[model samples]
Target: MAGTNLKCRECATTYELEPRYVCEQCFGPLEVAYDHSRFVDDVGALRRRIQGGPQNIWRYGDFLPLDGPPGPALRSASRVGLPAGCTPLLRADRLAERVGLGEVWVKNDAHNPTHSFKDRVVAVASQRARELGFDTLACASTGNLANAVAAQAAALGLPSYVFIPSDLEEQKILATGVYGTNLVKVRGNYDDVNRLCTELSGEREGWAFVNVNMRPYYAEGSKTLSYEIAEQLGWATPDRVVAPIASGSLFTKIAKGFEEWLELGLIEGSVPTMNGAQAVGCSPVAQAFDAGADVCRPVKPDTIAKSLAIGNPADGPYALELARRTGGAIDAVDDDEIRAGIRLLAETTGIFTETAGGVTTATLAKLAARGDIGADEKVVIVITGDGLKTLDAVRDTFESYEIEPRLEAFEAAVEQGVHV
Candidate 1:
């Protein structure tokens, strides 16, 4: 594990791993690099390390680029990231059969502390924010990130400042507010809030922006989803997987996870076909991928999935390439289709996922109908957040079966097979 360096993904130029994310030589992105040999002959050793470590993301610290593991004082007080990795990998047999797939898995990340996958990224970002000598945490969020930043900061006793669109769901805003963040609701959409945060980061001082400055590290947390999936599957990959894309980072990182695990000899399997879902209302990434563009064009946000409403994704270009390289596609479904997706998953899996989850499940049905998911390919669908955050999106899907609280009414309904 010695001589670890940060290497430019573009030019292969290496540098001492420091508090930097971009390449100095080629201006390309710099990513954490390691001696692959460390993982070459120690799968059992690594497995033991993970089993012995705390039940959080730290179990995969060897794969992480931490300068060194954080101290106990900081780790103990960390409110957000108490090693929040091991999400359930349900067989999803009933759901898969209903969706017409062979073998299906649901990576239910809603079990995290903050009830969303954002907790994984925020945990890493919060740790790095501390290590980088910052006392305040801030972010430009759609919904989930705002809540995660506030919750993580509160857990660590770090002051938090957050910004988001004014039109965000009441539940999300309240979630962050309850954590005592200096929350600012911008008048426009998510993109507007992001622009303001970017400007603030440039003009302001003494603040750590989770989605910006600490972003590279924050994004790395998404890779843990892949790591857990493979480990839970007994060190193998699924045939295909569907993810909900907003900034497009999640889809790309999940792919990177499989690649790194393979390179480390931690898992032996082919990479999953990584398709992504987006709302048709705001799908610049999907549009760019469909149009064969190298970059995603930013657009106005207008989707029920507020958490997945980043019109201008920082990782959109990389995401498109990942989908294409893996023989997958990024597709967008309409509001109706998205709502249907949510209902379908809830009825079949007994899991109430947010709009993004609906996007994934609905798109799974769409792809299955078009024969994108063959009858025998093993599929995994990621459910990132709890549905309670956006109840309004699916509140109308059910018909009112209201009746008087009487035995005659109940009998009438029962005679109509309503109870069944």
Candidate 2:
């Protein structure tokens, strides 16, 4: 499908694709409704087109909402490449050995433009911002989203305004601010900042809130991760996927990505299981899943995995659906587990993931322990952000172990098998 109409998910009523996000008829959430039959007519051609196109996520433009040939925004996207969607599908042999899995891979998105996979979604969001005639782009973020919004908007020549919690990582806060955007630090947690942003959207007219109203298309960007994973695995879907749970959007959208690829015949097999991983202190969705609830109950944040601390995730219900349909599991890990997960990943795979990735690894460990993930199953764990970004979390857990410019001390430490 070249373009799509919007259909309400709840009522099945259709609407024209406009700037509106919600259904005017039934007040239901509107989603992109593609002409699937027509879109599937040339799946091979679609694959060839994507293979021959630029390296960014827009290589699959035929699947997106673009109205014509690649526009100026798309051209710019291509030139930069951002090396966005084509991140490494690293085979974690060491990690597999530790976890006792026959096959395990890490989709390392920490290498993105702003040092997180948020760039993929935010890239599409920023492009949509320019396409929809908005001069300013904005979002409510705990950390990663803020960094992405500032960087993408700045790169795209749009004024950016990021609203973030005051208790966010100092590195993340400074990273966004250094982009020279308008960074507003709210004195509460992420949920509070999100609430404020939701209210402000009503008052702001020309501003495009990327994660709010511009979110539907913005969320579509996350599908690229799943798309890449499938393609990298030789045009077949994996057996399982474990991803960090933030607003629950990423995990749900990644599953959607694989589903769309299957529907469009981009992949030859059925979609993989989508598992959700969360930090224990901020795991509202995990609690809901554990309790067999339909929706996640909101809670106050209390986790070092600040990036995944969205207690009131918007896509929690969808996440539950994805996991249940894939026969996957969702679980949470405590702060200590998160830290150990990070260390385990770093030691085994040479990927320095923040606590969010730690959550995924820790949950993957738990899933393996519960015999949920099979030894021979092909599993992909997403590492969203770099560990160095949240130095505070693991600061005391690690130290320099400096030896005062002495070879003798280094020899002693080496003999002791110590981290020097």
Instruction: Output the TM-score of candidate 2.
Output: 0.94
- TM-score per candidate, in order? 0.93, 0.94
Q: Candidate 1 on 1-420: residue-level lDDT in tens?
A: 222877777899987755456677887776666776756777888877766766667667776656555533454665334456788989888887887778888999989888899988888777777777878999999888888888888888889999999999999999889999999999998888887987787666778887776666778789889988998898888889899999888998999889988877778778889898999988999999889999998988788988898888878888899899999999999999989999998998899999999899988988888888888898999999989889999886886455689999988886776632
Worst 10 residues of 1 by lDDT: 71-80
| Tens digit per residue, CA lDDT, model 2, 305-405 | 99998988988888887888788868999999999899999989888998899999999888888888777898999999998889877777775556657
The prediction achieving the highest TM-score against the true structure is 2
- For each candidate, C-alpha RMSD in Å? 2.5, 2.3
Kindly report which residue pairs in candidate 1 clash with one another.
56-83, 57-83
